[model samples]
Structure formats: structure tokens, C-alpha cells
Target: MYQRYHPDKNANDPKAADMFKEVTFSYNILSDPDKRRQYDSAGFEAVESDNQELELDLSSLGAVNTMFAALFSKLGVPIKTTVSASVLEEALNGLVTIRPLPLGHYVSKRVEKQCAHFYSVTITEEEARAGFVCRVQSSDKSKFKLLYFDQEDNGGLSLALQEDSAKTGKVTSAGMFFLGFPVYRLDQTMNSIAAAKDPDTSFFRKLDGFQPCELNELKAGTHVFAVYGDNFFKSANYTIEALCAAPFSEEKENLRSIEAQILSKRAEISKFEAEYREVLAQFSEMTSRYAHEIQSIDELLKHRNEIHASYTITPFKRSTSKSRSKSSSKENKEDGQTREKRSTRDRPKKKKWYNIHLRVDKRKAC
Candidate 1:
């Protein structure tokens, strides 16, 4: 259908051009998984909200170029021929302004929508071995995509997408690219074997399914391209930077040593954790075994306290010394009086004998 309604083939027919655009539009939505899902659930409105309509004018392209573009589109690899491929070519041909991007420094540029900015970065073999990362930060909050060129088998340039900010939904304007050295890959695998390593690094954690470029593919001199896509409405003012993973080349050896030590420490930690868990289990078993005894001992102590309290005696209080002396003196005096009374009673018998004579006299007188 694309071939039949292609603008180049039907150059005289305006209706054919309209049909061609319509066919292209439909193909784009159906080809993309996200767009297709959106369209399936909520029709064109849902699809449009996420992505703008793709407009292609194949009439401006040669027959061969148009044929290849259509072929790639059918294969579900739609080519953005206008911005990415052309920008790379122009940079290589010295037709466009290519700014030098220094390592660890940011170079800022404003890129118009549907346009691209080019940058050149130099790296040494050591830096490449240690690994390098390139990042683009957008100031305008515009959605953009990063691109870089790879050498084809025929020594021609092929544009590759480094990162896309739209699908990632990270910072709306920031995207990062990293070329991981063989050593780094090996280190990662070793770490994975040593422990449960996280597949995503903190630097690119928000980017789902991010994969770094192979170190062998990265040469000493490389150019990076940033394409401000038409996904959003405005142009982007962005900064780009290239950084080596290892800050100093001499530190690479230290890094390897540290990694080995880390693996060793991780192994030690694993052993310690196992021992800790075993000890914890033993401690728990011992505690459980003694729990009933401890509780019973506590209960017995409470019972003993209750019994002791029930039998506890209240002692009588003693009087002070002064009151005791006073009471003792009074008792002594009373005792003396009793003794005198007893003595007088004994004497009474004798007095009565004397009185007997007087009593007899009185009786006579009576």
C-alpha cells in the first residue's frame, strides 16, 4: 500500500499523496507497541496524547532511499532519516558545527525541535578500558533522544539510539549513555556471582532495561549526537558531558583490588549471617525451654510472698522510759500498802485478847 500510494510514484496525483500520508500514519501507530495498545484501548485520542503524528514526505527522497525507508518501516524499525542520519553525516563531512566536549565538563547547546546537535569527545585506551559515560541534560523540560554513529561493515556510518527520554519518563530531558569496558562487565558478573547484585545501577536506575554499549565498539575518538525530537512542542537547551568511570587511570588497579576485597567481605558477611541465624535459633530454643521454668519460679515467689504476708505478726509497742518508771513506782507503792495490811491483821489477834478483858467488863456492866 505504501509503494502504491508513494508520493514519488504518484507525483501527479494529489490524492495519492494524501493517501500516502494516511497510510504512513496508520502504519506508525500500528507498528509501535505502546501506540497500538493505546489505540486499542482508547482509539486515536489516546495514541495522539503520547506521541505526535509522524509525517513523511517521500517525494523529496530519491527512489532508492524511499524504498529502503519503507522497507525498514515494514520491518518495524522506522528510520528518522531527516534528523539523525543527516546530522551524523554532516558532522562527519565537516558541514555542521561540531563542538569539542571535554571530559568531566558540560557543553551546553540549544537544539530546535526535530533538529540535532553534534559533539566530539576524545578518550585514551586506558579510559576506554576503565569505561566511559556520556550524559545529556535538558534545561527546557523538553523530551529528546540521544544518538551516536557506529561504523557499518562497509565502513559507512549507521545511526544508533543511545537513549530516549520519552519512553523512560525519567527527568523529561535527561538521558545517559555508557560504554562499559570488558573489565567492568567482568566485575559486574563477578559481583553478581558473589552476591545478589542489582541489575540496574543508581545512575541509570530510572531507565528501564538500560544496557551499556560494548567497550570494543568504542574507539579513541568518538562523536555524540543529541537530537531534540518533535515529541514535545518546544526546543531544548541542553548540556552534554563525557566522563570516565574511573577518575584516574592509576585507580583502575585499586578498583580491582577493592572489588576483590568486597567479594571477600561479602563472603564473610554471608558466613556471619548464617552463623547469626543459627545462634539466634539456638538462643530462641534455650529461651523457650526455660520460659516455663522462669514463669513457674515467678509464680512460686508470688505465692511465697502471699503466705508470708498472711502469717506475719504485729509486735506490741513499748512505752517510753519516763512512763515506764512512773508506772513501776506506783506498783511498788501499792505492794507496800498490801504488806502493811497483812502485818496489821497478824497483830489484831493480840489486840483482841487485850480487848477481851474490857469486853468482859463491859458485858458485866451491861
Candidate 2:
């Protein structure tokens, strides 16, 4: 029907031209087995890269007739047609199976590059509500483990992504391991680095030899991705993909306990600070009051010294005034006695004249 309805044959219909091109494009890819396989497996983009145009011959309409006959049979119609036209090219994944392969076959070939690796892991809300495990491994047989903490985990992934983009190729794995690119919590010194870089740190109870590097009860979002490797390993291949998930009750409880402890500590610190300030204020007030008291005592002591000096001089002054008064009284008594004796000597002559007159009267009487 493509040739019967093609715009070249039916020149008035522009819509039929579009249908003709579509039929030709499909035939170009489907007719070629190589292009058909490429289209089926990898999609149209692979076949389009070939960049071939298909020629539809009006004379050789046998295959086109057969194809329409089959399609119309399925649609309960009987039609066969072809078009004389050229096919144009155009461009545009599916099921994955998990089967266990022998370790020696697929494992040894998996090698790590000498660059910092960045991985974006998406966990669904359900996956985060339940806990998930992400497995990491190294190609260089490096021993290491993952450390999970709120403040530190996201920082590791960011640093690795930055370093991977900045480096020309990659530094040697030795340099990466030594510099602690993925941020191992374990020691990496010469003596202890060997034992400290234990690969499996997580402990599982029921499963034998089970280790769980799990993100337990994470908040629903994109989480931190990081890897830690041995300081001396040449190269290490690591995976940051979620493996499995399970519901976690203990994790929520642990978070609550930690939060309570933090709050308790903060309260204690605030209480201590308040008490310290109160004590400091009290000490300052006491110091000021005692200082004023000391000053008052000093002034009182000065006044007592002045009073003591005046008292010392006062006794001497009293004794000197008493001795001068005693001497003056004795001189005044001596002067009075001398004046009385002079008066008595001047009165004896008058007494003798009166006695002579009286003696003359007495001789007459005798």
C-alpha cells in the first residue's frame, strides 16, 4: 500500500509523502540483517550511524507486496503495494539478569583505575526507611573499611569527585591511598596501617562471616558515597551501590538516645555557665564591700594616731602649768609678809609716846 498511497504517485496528498518516507526508512533497516540486529539490540541510533538511504524500486515490488499481504492478513484486509522513493535515516536499553559467575573468571579482570572515583547512589524513600547495604571492593587486594558519621560521610564523596575531575590522569594508587582520598577512619601509619585497614568492619549476628556496611535508617534522599583503601595498595576497585535492604528499629532508637545525650550535655554546660557568672558577680560585689571597709579602717587608724599624739602632749602641758602656779603662789605669800613687817616697825614709835604719857601719870599716883 506504500506505493499505492505514496505522495509521488498521489501528488496532491502531502500526508502520503510523509507515510512513504516512513515505510522506506523502516524497510532500509529491516531488510538489512546487520542493520536489523543493530536496531533491535542497540536501538535506532546505531543503525542511523551507518547513514545509508534506501531505494524503493517500483519494478521490484515483490517483497513489498508480500509484506503488505502479511500485515493486511493480520488486520483482516487484502492489500499489496509499493512506492518508488528513497529512505531517510533517523536515530534513537532492557532486561538485566543476575547469574553467579565463578570468582576467578570475572573477578581478577576487574581492576581499579589510579584515579579518585565518584559514584552517585540513589536510594528510594522505601529503601531508606528500610536500611540498605553498599558493598565496596578493591582490585589491588587493598584492605579497607567504610566509616559512617553524619558530619564526615558526605564530605568524602565531595572530595573524591573534586579530585577525580582536577587530576590530569590520576595520581598513583599509592599516592591516593597515602593521602587518604576516600577518608579512612583507620590509622595508616607504617606499623599499624596493616592491621588497621581491616576490610570488613560491620558485624552481623545470624549469618556466618557476615559483615554489614549498611546505611541503617537513613533519611530519604541521596546519601554520601565514599571509599577507603589500603595505604600501600597499587589500585583498588570499589563499588558504591546498594545491595539489599531491611527494616531497622534499633537505628531509630539509637538516634533518639544520642539526641537525648546531646541535649543533656548542652543543658549541663548552660547550667555551669550560669552558675559561674553568678559566682563571679558575687565575688566582685564582696571585693568592693571589703575594699570600702578596709579604707574606713585605715581612716579610723589615722584619726586614732592623731588623738594619741595630742593625748601624749596634753599631760606634759598640764604638769608645766601646775608647777608654775605653785611657784607664783609662794612668791605672793613672801611679798605680803614683808609688807606686814614694815607696817609693824613703823607703828612702835607711836606706842612709846602713849607709854611715856601713861608713865608720867603712874609716877604721880605712886
Candidate 3:
């Protein structure tokens, strides 16, 4: 159920750590010229490239790797060898584990560009948000619960119904994956570069965008709206239970569990961030310390590019083709009605209520 790349990185970038994380994030392989041709020819085994399934279960990375090795061996493709480098190890450190979200009638779309409901938000502010934005309204008194957690499961925090707009929104359940997201997580990647030009949200498209929602324009207190879609009318309206992560902070123990785990993990990440910063500082220092060395983001990128071009892989077996497969392999069951591609519900369910069970790690107060 994990969507992973064969573990390939572009290998051309100067910063192995940053590039590997970006590549691994896409479930790709790290293919530098120094690695196996089998890795390069085969490329990534795209999981429909619709990462809507569950997060990659982090605990299972080795198991997942073994599974892929078996799958690729069966498919006649072997993983690249550079997968063993420090860059990959670092990226895998952040690899998340999620169950595969189903691909049914659910349609997925990312927010290419969204103007605020009001004008106080500027383009710079919107860019900083780096989040998905969508609105789901249900009028049937059916409640909508929103959940948030880290990209990985290693963190023990899962938050339920954390609507910023609501103060007393109850924390009904934590670790309840099924009741939330009902179909798909918000697509945060800017999928269509062309979409940047058309920044309007029609009723049809807005219902489809599953990014994080914002209630900033509304009154500080609670307000009512209909959460729509998924068999409510021609669509449905769900009564939103709360707004952001602000609704529930009463369970101090769970909060502590979340904070502790995140801090522990952040400590590791912070270590790396510090190293990255130190290396950068050293490079700058070296640029001056050693008169011959060049220093700049551009110069470093070029230097990184040259290293990969000349590197060579041993024990090579080359393949002759590339493939980009889509969920089209799984046909829709209904001709008229779209197949259910994703459900925020952890599993397929007949029950309708969002049983949210989650706790979020507390960040340092800004």
C-alpha cells in the first residue's frame, strides 16, 4: 500500500541531501552515472503518481524496499546502487508511510493559485502558505471533521477536528484515519503549470480541491456552512464540526506524547539542518580561506552537475524503454458514475460520520 519510487534521484544536483529528499519524496530512485544501468533504464515504478493513498508507513521502509526488490526482479528491473549513499539515507530518514488511498470516483486537484476570499492576503503571503486550499460544505447537519498529522507515522500525533475558527471543538478520537479526508488528502503540488494562469474557483472545481482549508475570512466565532459532496444530494452537505487544529487542546497527555515524539524527531532534523548550515558556512569560509575555490549557489550547482556526469556504475544491465502508467489500469466500475478513487476514511466504509482520532505536535510559539 506504500507508494514509493524505485528510489531514484536525478543525481545531477550538487546537494545530495536536498536532491535525494526531493527525489525520494516522489518515490523515485537515486540514479547517478556511477550506479547501475538497470536502475536508470527502469526509472521509477510510479504508483499512479496519485499519492492519494495513505502515507507511506515509515516503520515498513525496509519491508517496503524488500517488496519492491521482489516486484522489480519479477518485472526485470533492479534498483540502482547509489541507493546506499548518505544522501538517500538522509531522505529515507524523512520517508513517510501511508496506506494506499483508494482511487475511485474521487477526483484530485491541487491549488495552483488561490486569491483570498478578501484582498488582505497578497501573492507573497499566499506563496508562503505552501498549502492546499479548498472548501467542503455540508448542509444536511452531517458533521465534517478535519484531521492533521506529520507526513510520517513515526510521530505519535494525530489531531482531530482542529478548526482554528472553533475553540471548544471536541477531540473525539485520535488515530481515527477513516472518518477524516473521506476520499483524498489535499494535493499540494502545483500539478498544472498552466493552471497558474486561471486562478478562479468554480463550484465544481472548489468541491474537488482537497487542500487544507482556511476560515480566516469568517468571524472569529463559529459560523455554519454546508459540507458538500459524496452522495449528499446530487452532492452532499456535511455540518463542519470545527475549523483548524485550534479546536482541541484538552488532552494534555496526548499533546505531550505528540510534542515529545516530534521534538525527538526534530532534534534529528535540526541536527541535519545545523550540519547543512555549517557546511554552507564552511564553503563560504573556504571560498575566502582558499583563494582558488569558487563560492555561490550557482557555482556549487554546476560543480554538482559535473560530478554526476562523469560518475560510472558497475555490474550494469541496461534496459531499452521507459513507462508512465496511470490508474487507467484500474478501470472505473460504473460507466456514468466515476469510480471512487480516494476516501479520507481509512478504509472502505458504509458508516458516514468522521471519527477523528489525532494529536499534533506543538511547535515553538513564534
Candidate 4:
């Protein structure tokens, strides 16, 4: 490049003190192989990372405001600002801005006054995909039907849709879009900006009265439909939008999410029901055991030959020796019977204690 310096120029006047001089400074231009290769292959977005503050042209800024004012005239706004040359200069300085995206309208297919095919664009505060282009989709793209034509073949289908449409298969599209690359030819480096036609292209400039030839192939992101003819072609770029089913698809997504929540809640209720069934089964087992214990206690209480505090003793004489011997046998038999009766009473009393504990649950009081 060059170096900056002050040179001696004035002799007497203070106004002509030392004048600025241009010094030729030698600089070796260097390019890294990795970065150079990436820049060559990447899309329009690749270079924007380093260009934080895009260069502003005063004239282009004025043009953007002029276009906005023309549009607002039909918008029926209550207040309008008067445009002064000085105010325009301030607007051009960056008070108002043309974002990466812009306000767009649907290109009317009415070719009587307007272009035959045009783009219907929805404007919002969002960065548009650079080089965003669309092509006419065919009606019956069963097999890959390749079609291409230049200005020589001015043939284009009216894009007729089918009867059972929107369910399956490509319905006819009413518009056309840039099927090729979307490189912008705006020379922001200069003050003037326009959609530079191919005449300005280097190769097209050299040719006189030349018709451009384009090659159409199945690319990665191209949309497709089927047409009856193998070849029907027109060269001018056209854009249109198909009416998507029920606008605001984001709302539909919210409904789907609500349905999912309902299903999840139902699953939780089912799980609770299953857990309740398990608890009921455990309660049933406990109830069956309590019933068996109650039956055992009932049998013990109803035993006919036993009663509490009653001694079983047979009657016998207390005087004669033979009678006394008989009395001893009677006494032995009575003691054995009494002992058996007492043990039964004590064991059955445990069943009563079990019943008491079984009825101790709070629900039993209720």
C-alpha cells in the first residue's frame, strides 16, 4: 500500500504550512490458502461475518425513503411527515434503515398490465435467506421430467391445478420464481443501486444481440411438480405463492402440543388407577385373614363343653375305702379335664385380643 506523511511546501504563509504528501509504501499482499478456498465456495452469507458496518451510500438511502413514502401515500396513515432535502440527508445518514429484509407484495399474475409471473412475499422483521428463489412445481412428477428453454421457446404452461388437490401430488402453481442463483447485483460500493440485468454481466456485455441459454437440472433444494409436456419453456423470472392450508401454521403446532398434554394427563390418571388396584388387592388379602381369625374366635367361644371359671369334677362318696379309691380316680379325671378347659379359654382369649387390634384402625370408629 502507502504510508501517510507531511511534506514541506509553504515558504511564507501560515495557511500553507506543511502540506500532506502521499508516500509510496511497499506492502506484500498475503492470502491464506484456507480462507481463500472457503471464500471462493461459500454462499452470500459467508462474507457478511466481517462486514459489521455495511458501507452506506447517501443516494441509495434517499431512494429507499422515496420508495417508502410512495407506499405510505396509499396506506391512509393519519400523520405524514414533510420531506425536506436536509431531513433526507439525515435519513440517509442512518436514522431510517433498509434492513436485510424488505416489504414485499404478491406479484399479480395479471400480465395485461403487470408482469406475467411474480413473487408474493410476506414481509416481517426477519433475515431472509439470501438468494431465495422458487421454481414452478409440476402436476404429475412421477418420473424426473427435465425441461429447459431460452427466449426462443416462449412457451409456459398456465399452471393448471388438479381436482383432488392439497391431499397429495403437486398441484399447479400460478406463479414462477428465480429457479437459478439469487446473487444481488447491487453495487452498494457506489451510490447507485439496482437489480442489475444480465447486460451488465461481463460475459453478456461482450456479446451483441445474444439470447441467454440456461441449463435446468435437479438440484438439492429445488421444488418440483409434474407437467404433461416434456418441454414447455419461458426465460423471464416469475414468482408466485400457493395458498397454504389454514394460515398461521404456528397456531396448529400449539394445538398439537395441547393434545399431547391431554394424552400425558390421561396416562397419569391411568397410572394412579393401577396403583389403587394394587392397594385394593393388598387390602382384600388383609380382610380375608381377619375373617379367618374372627371365625376361629367364634368357634372357640361357641365350644359347648367349655365355660370360664367352671371346674369339671365328677360326684363320689367321701367315707368308705372302695368309695375313696373311686373318689381318687374321679378327682384325677376331673383335674385333667379342668386343665384342658383352662388352656382352651386362655388360647381363645388371644383371638379376642386379635379382634381388638383388628378394630383399632381409625376407619372402624367412623
- Every candidate's CA RMSD: 21.7, 36.1, 43.4, 35.8
What's the TM-score of every candidate structure?
0.37, 0.25, 0.17, 0.17
Off by over 4 Å in 3: 1-222, 225-252, 273-366
In angstroms, give how far residue 268 of model 1 lies from its true place. Answer: 27
Backbone clash pairs in model 4 (N, Cα, C under 3 Å; residues 3+ apart or in different chains), count: 7
lDDT of 1 by residue, 188-255 (tens): 11221112122232112222222333433355666555454633235776667788877655555565
Note the Cα lDDT for every prediction shown. Answer: 0.56, 0.40, 0.31, 0.31
Error of 2 at 276 (Å): 4.2
Clash count for each candidate, listed in order shown:
0, 4, 71, 7
**Across residues 1-366, which tens digit of lDDT does each residue of candidate 4 receive?**
101211122223222111110000000001224444555688334443422212211122345433432232223211112222332333334232221211232222221111122122332222122212223433432111111211112322222221101112544332222223211111121211111222133222222212222321223221322211111122222223332213434544564465456556656755666776689789999999999999999988877446642554754345676887898999999999999999888874335554664535776755
For lDDT, candidate 2 versus 3, the one ahead is: 2
Best lDDT among the predictions, by candidate number: 1
- Off-target runs (Cα >4 Å) in candidate 2 are 1-127, 132-252, 265-276, 314-366
The residue ranges of model 1 lying beyond 4 angstroms of the native Cα positions read 1-94, 151-157, 166-170, 173-217, 248-366
Q: By the TM-score metric, which is better: model 1 or model 2?
A: 1
Q: What is the lDDT for 271 in model 2?
A: 65
Leading candidate by TM-score = 1
TM-score of 3: 0.17
